[model samples]
Target: MLFVAAMLAARPGLSQQASLEEKWRALFAQTSPAAAEEHIDAVLAACGDSPAALRKLFACDSAYPQLGGGLHRRATTVVDGETRYDVEYVVRVPGGYSPVRSCALLLAAHGQGGSGASITAMMQRGLGAEVEKYIIVAPTLPGPRRYAGAAYQEQAYLKPLAWARLNLNVDDDRIYVSGHSLGGHCTWHLATMFPHLFAAAVPMAGVPLFEGSPYTSNSYLENLANLPVWAIWGELDQKGPGTLSNVHFCRMAAERLRQLGNSKFEGTELPGVGHAGWWPKPEAYARYLTSHKRLAAPEKLVHFFHRARHGRAYYVEAIRLARDELDFSRRPQPKLRVQPGESLAEAAIRTGKQVYDKSLFKIWADLDKGANAMSIRASGVSAVRVYATEGMFDLSRPVTLRFAGRSWTGGISASARCMLTHYAATRDATAVICNEVDVDSAGKVLVRFGPSGGGETAE
Candidate 1:
């Protein structure tokens, strides 16, 4: 790993007061555009000073409506039991000090050969000072950005945000996050490990979620219901192994979020760009920062829709993939409509429940003009628990419902609700009620129920 060693050696030589922005530019010239961002992030990590010293030296112009930012270095204490290292961070605060205002935070973790420097540079110049209205903290991640303990490294950085604020005046509501490569890996760790922490995330060219629990990490990952995230990848980048289901991971993640009724989930596969394309489109990501909004970036809506739709579709497909008997078979070109926020998973969990916001579903019963339909079968349900709004209920069209009874016939019909449920899965198909309807049989005879009232009939 001499290559890795040389990159880490580039650090100690970095001046404590080297220009964060200038170094970023030079890094761009010295390294491939892809590695430059991480390198710059590395420089930032090496520039740590004591917290008290930083408080005095940390200076900036007042954050204007969209004009504010500068190089700020600070070292905060990180305590994990008795051992504590001075974790450094370079911040680009959007605006200057003002009255109490809500803030969004973008916590950038550096990859191997990089530190807070490049991450800091990215926050300042790439996204610009107008982005400073919110605080962007880039921490110097450990071990030259190694994968081992990355999840803990992420959690280590995030824990102090609240604790640091307990002594300061940091706002807790508007934190947003993202990272690239190894840092992106850390971002994934942080987001899922603590999904309750962010509004949205955009992970660029990082590893897909792996099961880190049982052996090392404390737990395994379930489909998250509270967080909405967007993942990004370069189609050709293999240095970080971006080819392994990275796009599919984001797509599936978006689908899961949709199942939670959150249509805001997003992911994008940036064509032709590799791991280092952050510079070319950094501005496109500026708005998700929670403090600044870039009106000029067009990709915002485009990426948003891509992930949302893919996420919605995936959640719907998962039920069939679960293959709960019904002798399920695949169909070509299944027509499933998308309700506003319904991710594939969120929709499936809502079957047979009350819906306050009808906007969050792709109920097969809702299609007015579509000519095709879907069918399902169920056996038994130990406990048909509705999915908690803050719980997993990913659903979409062509959904499969599980209930009790001998496959009933006679043109029966039903719809989905925003409510989610957990039908204790088993090998026996005789537990829960299953939805069964074919394309031609879809619109003809309809029986349904509503939140306002309930009635059953044959259409």
Candidate 2:
């Protein structure tokens, strides 16, 4: 509450801006998603009518609350079968931490049978003195085996990261995720599904491909095009019956990345090293993690996804994909292997239905904000939402969108609806969008506007 009071006292001048600030405070103060969304309506109402003004207001980054430094154990609420429970996580705030200086965040997930406390302790040991440059967060990932999937994404990762952003001075561009073994698998999952949220990913001794339900990392290789991946594993880990070894998967990933035109991936295989590979020393680890920063608004983006929920890469999102079951989940089928004497085409024809790539969706988008023009190439995707922020382009100019050989060139007005709705959904004020343009596969253009404005369409 004192932090809220400080924010109120810091800005005293105009009543309008002050009113919006109060609304923001009220919005962030809500603990639950439903409450937060309900509060967004009030915030939108307080913004009057201008989308540009709303963008400016929301662009004001909130100051980090005065939270003393230390390892703090926090709990986030989660729901299951109409019942709710609390999930615990550990956050390591560097000694002598100050709200004035922004620091990198490291999401250290633990392996099977390990808890958040153990992972946090391991990070403290590994990072040593260099840990002072980061705020390390370790969540006791949910599920009996502490699996890394959609549930972990929401409860363990997203919730904790949201808390850190609101309460700590976290550098959005310097965030990193790393894990070992099962945690390493989680690291790969997080990096593949949410590359936009991380600058780099370090996965030690874990392969994304494992026999399991809900598929593995093979289908999402293109998503790693821009994210720097440092995959380290023992050459002898998990090599046996029903296993293809971590080194094998890492090598395959490197090859796939190359095929995807990605040169940002690196795979290091240690001789004789087993499942528990190794971690870089404190100084080296810090230097590697801090050397890279996330590209907030890349001019070009490539993303491939099996589920539409993970379709967001950066400025482009596949809001509506061509797939019937966007949230499909099932045990993965065996790959269509080419028989000893069968031709590759023959093998595909025989078991092509078991192939993963055939069912995937992809979107390639290039933005030329200077010309106010953007082009998109999509496959198995029905519709996309393109976000426009002041950081990406000048919203004051006419924006042109081209898809499927059709082009629409018109001025796009910032919409309060788009701004508020996006903020409510993401809770990320750093990349809050001013406006969004929704386009369909057939070249239909829908520029979303708030209550004060009307929808505009172009062929």
- Top-lDDT candidate index: 2
Q: How many angstroms is residue 146 displaced in model 2 relative to the true structure, after the best TM-score fit?
A: 6.0
- Residues 1-459, model 2: lDDT tens digits: 333343344343435346656676677666543346567776666655556555455445453467777889988877655656567899989887886567789999887788889988888888888877889988887756645465444456767877776677777778899988878888888888788988999987776632232234466777787888988888778741123456666766777677877888887878877776367677776777888998767888888776656778788888887766443445434566899986554354335324555677789989887888899989888888888864776767777888867888887776777776666544455676777788987888887763465677766
Which tens-of-lDDT digit does each residue in 1-459 have in candidate 1?
A: 222232333333544345533443344334133334455344334333121211111111111133234557766655544656567766656546342343455677666577888876665665665465567777786433465433246445674454323222234445667777776666766665455445566667765443221111111123233455667777665554322334444444555555656555566767786667554354566755553221111111111100111111111211211112211122112234446887553333232111211111111111111322223221111111111111012223332222222122242322211110011111011112122222111222222333222433332
Model 2, position 447: C-alpha lDDT score: 79
Worst 10 residues of 2 by lDDT: 208-217
Q: What TM-score quantifies how close candidate 2 is to the native fold? A: 0.83
Segments of candidate 1 deviating more than 4 angstroms: 1-70, 76-86, 149-151, 209-223, 241-262, 279-283, 291-459
lDDT of 2 at 377: 87
Global lDDT of each candidate: 0.40, 0.71
**What's the CA error at residue 72 for candidate 2, in Å?**
1.6
Task: State every prediction's TM-score relative to the real structure.
Answer: 0.44, 0.83
